[model samples]
Target: MKKTILLLIIISTIISCKTVKPSAENNVLVLKGTVEKMGMSTFQYGTHLLKTESKTYALKTAIVKLDDYVGKEVSITGSKVEGYPVENGPDLIDVKKIVIK
Candidate 1:
């Protein structure tokens, strides 16, 4: 009886550990760094910029609705889109939060 109960508990725990998909309500990965460069033209959506590590990324529309957030320290989060940094790009990241830090 004890072994059976233990087995059931383990199985339940494992099943409950599945990863949840990022959603608009809770789909923001916090990022901290100085904004290396911001997109100047309207072609780029939602303030596209890079981090200190030179990684290119963009904030989702939820955070800020501007194409200028350059040269500033910021903390933001958004759904990670596959292809970004392109003009009029299809890459879309669902932002959850953004904070200047």
Candidate 2:
């Protein structure tokens, strides 16, 4: 009887556990362009810039070194940070993954 109850409790606990996902992953957006080191900026943010045919994005990442991908055309997956495009700058993205094209 005790063994049966313990087994049931363990099963319930396992089933009730929820997987945690990164907050940034929830707003996944993709951008493809050539990356370049951002020059001097008075209002613009981010360490790098991605220029596409239609738009541009300012990008920063804590997961990897974006400098390695500078001057290279790459596809990036990221989330837009809130309160961005400030001062007529490009949208800021928290880069999650980047792949050279």
**Best-matching candidate per TM-score:** 2
Q: How close is candidate 1 to the true structure, as a TM-score?
A: 0.45
The positional error of residue 82 in candidate 1, measured at the CA in angstroms, is 5.5
Query: Which whole-number lDDT from 0 to 100 does residue 68 have in model 2?
Result: 95
> Each candidate: RMSD to true structure?
5.7, 3.7
lDDT of 2 by residue, 43-78 (tens): 668999999989988998899699999989999999
> Residue 14 lDDT in model 2?
69
Flag regions of model 1 displaced more than 4 Å.
Answer: 1-27, 36-46, 66-68, 82-92
Worst 10 residues of 2 by lDDT: 16-25
- Residues 13-92, model 1: lDDT tens digits: 87776444434445446666665434465555645554645455555565564345567777767666656647754345
What are the TM-scores, per candidate, against the unseen true structure?
0.45, 0.73
After superposition, the stretches of candidate 2 with alpha carbons farther than 4 Å from their true spots are 1-23
